[model samples]
Target chain A: MQRSLAARVAARTAALRLTNEKLYNEILERRKAERALRATERKYRGFFENSIEGAYQSTAEGQYLNVNPALARLYGYATTAEMMAAVGNIARDVYADPEMRLRFQEMIERDGKVRNLEYQVRQRTGEILWISESARVVRNRSGKIVCYEGTIRDITARKRAEDEAARLRQQMLQLQKMDAIGTLASGIAHDFNNILGGIMGYVELAQDDLPPGSGAESHLKEVWKAIHRAKQLVRQILAFSREAAPERRKVRLAMLVSEATRLLRATIPATVAIEEEILTETDEIIADPAQIHQVLVNLGTNASHAMSGRAGRLLLRLEHAAIGGKKPALKLSVRDTGHGIPPDILQRIFEPFFTTKGVHEGTGLGLSVVHGIVKSHGGEIRVESTPGAGTTFMIFLPLALEAPQ
Target chain B: MAHILVIEDDEHMRGSLAQTLERLGHRVTTAVDGKVGVASAAVAPPDLVITDLIMPEKEGLETIMELRQHQPSIRIIAMSGGGRLSNEDYLHLAKRFGAQFTLAKPFTRDELKAVLAQALAS
Candidate 1:
């Protein structure tokens, strides 16, 4: 009996010792696995901190799990801790437009990864910056989305440079348009000047041959009058051809208006009434006399045509005013009681070849030429009108103190 | 009356020139091309010839050269609108090829009469 009992005790002690050894081995294996996980995390942290681009990890719900110092600086925060405290949800706090975060989520869900997503992100100070991000979904072992990891780079300066280059290209196109118009004018002027020379020469010869009191002399006088009218037409052509220079002279605005009105009265139908209001007696301006005359004539003719088949009043008013506190200027306003310009067409009225008149009646260069002349003389012209009311053109020219002899 | 021959390609300008010269009491003959002009000048030897520079079949420079060879002292007047040639080049070629004088296109009646009178006197 004693020997049997002793064998039992020995068996039990051996079983206990085996169990302890197995437990110790299991603990050691678990400790080794923990150390390996810590090393991997340390290596990842080091890489994230040292990288130039911003590194971040966010939950699918947009909660930040980890962010590098580079990310905090990129977002205009002083430290990662500060950014984490303020920016609780990246989708809500950092993205200026919340739709951007949703778009990123959609991209990743569709493609398993989102590449180079560019958007404007709001900083801590409410300022916005452009950021480019490339990110991938972080998944658990079962392929379920847990978080997202991404790199961000600032691209604001590059975007600004592209916009500036586009603006300069548009400006160059406008200059090219002006250059082409100048070339066309030079060619047309050379041909037209020759024709005018022939006409003028023959008129002078016809005048010398006709007797003073005969019927032929009266007929010759009428022909001479027509030739004089044709010469004025030639001058207008020369203006566009670049052959004629602007004849600048210091003249009173009142006298210019009177002379223009007197000439226009003969051409406009007797039904249309013409009136003038000279507010300033000494309002003087330096301008090309011939060009100014042409401007007045063109405006008057346009007004007459606008009031065709209707009784209307055309008013030519001259006044003196100060602009921008610099100098006093003479203001000439041509107002007509006729159909007003539409809103859509007012913007393009000064463009070349844009006219409402029927074919063969208007060349469409009248307003464009007027605009060019006004711009060349350092003056300003503006049109004011309503849909139902008539239109008024007010031209402001710097006043000249010296008077013509 | 002085007999004058005119050669021009454009119908309107040619007709205007012929009428103006006829009104001035000069006998005028019109030709539409340089070859016809040269042939007319050769057969009749008109008192004066005014021909345009650019034309079909026979150009103005060649016509002037051939006309001078046929009638050495025929008194030719060259006219052009300076279309393809510069003013200086046109004058140079005309004088070089034995033309008495040259006038630009769209010439006035007075200028035509004066140049014709000068060419006839010379």
Candidate 2:
């Protein structure tokens, strides 16, 4: 009986050892599988962290569930946590146009995916950024949408470059139009000059045949003067069309002021008269004769408009001034007895596009262009006025040391 | 005084111009266009041919060139009341085509006379 009992106990011990070894191998296999799974998860996490393209996962209700660092940076946030806190609803708060996100969602829902969808989004800083997104709807086994997954790429720089190219093309077209107008203007000016030539030549021929101081000769002189004024108008139009650079030369201001006033007299109502106080003898400045003539004409026109057809005196003065009795400068002043400028707007008179005149009356560029021309020639201009009395514009220009070449 | 040929398209202008030249004591012949003017000049070969630059047939530029080919020593005066080109531009071209003198239209009689004197003297 003792020997049988000992043999059964030995068999039981061997079976227990065999079961323990199998349990140990099974535990080792499970640990190896767990370690392999953890390595795969880490590889994907690294991809999410280092990717340049923005990646995000959002709930069906538009709440951000997961966002990579790139996505946070693109939204103008310091961190993903900050982006999530700042943006509560993606469709309402993120999209520049909320409808765009709705359309994107509808497309993803219908097709299971959307590729290269373009939209504008407002960054956290309140600036709009152009972006293109490729996204897919994440659904559960029941085919119900649980969330959305997508990548966003900023296309703001590309859009800006395209806009700049379009602007350049428009500018080129404007320049071409100007060139065509210039060609047409040349032809018109030639024809007008020919007509004037006929009138001037006949008047001179009739004068040559007339006796000295005859009444007819004096009458012919008046007709010739009118034609001279007409010629000046034509020249001004030609200069504008050609955009010719002012022909800079030593020019006397007195001659230009009187000529401009004489031309103004024929156009303005007789109630308005012109006065001149030009005393500068041979005081010459380097200038384009036509441009100086234009400056006077513009100021005279402005003065006339201010008067508004009422009787008034337009005083034009040209003089030589010495600052502190040392440095010499040429001074010109245009004074108008009219409804003067109000104090509030006097400062903005020289600002470009600031005009009180109606659209058909003026472009408001007159004063600004005058200011630019004076500044380019090293000059200063100022205005003085009393609301009820009158207004005067004073212009000072440095004398050319030697005539500009 | 020399024999002058006036080629003008406008009748009124031609009449006035012809009268003025006659008063200055010069013998003058008139033609309506460059074609008639060339034929008239070839028949008589006047001392000086005053041709208009822009004409309906055989325009002034071509007229001047053709006249120079026929008579290399011909004294020619070209005048124009500008067309598509500027009067100065037309005048410059005329000078290039062997015109001795160029007058812009509606020029003073004294101016025309002065150009004629200079052309005849040279």
lDDT by residue (A113-216, candidate 1, tens digit) is 97888899998899998889999998889999988999999988987766655554454354335435644553353344345444545555566667777677
The CAPRI class of candidate 2 is: incorrect
Stretches of candidate 1 above 4 Å error?
A1-33, A88-92, A97-102, A139-144, A194-405, B1-122
Model 1: colliding residue pairs? none
Candidate 2 segments exceeding 4 Å error: A1-52, A59-63, A68-129, A134-145, A194-230, A244-405, B3-106, B110-114
User: Per-prediction TM-score, please?
Assistant: 0.42, 0.48
lDDT of candidate 2 over A1-405, digit per residue (tens): 999999999999899888888888888988898898888888888888779999999997899999999999999999999999988999988999998877887899999999989889999988999999998998999999989999999999998867765664564456446645754675566556556655665676577689898999889989988877867766665666647555777777788788777667655566878989987775677777665666677688788888876789999998998644566778899999989999988976864445799865665556855765676566778899998788999887666566345
Q: Just chain B of model 1: what TM-score? A: 0.92
Shift in Å, residue B35, candidate 2: 6.4
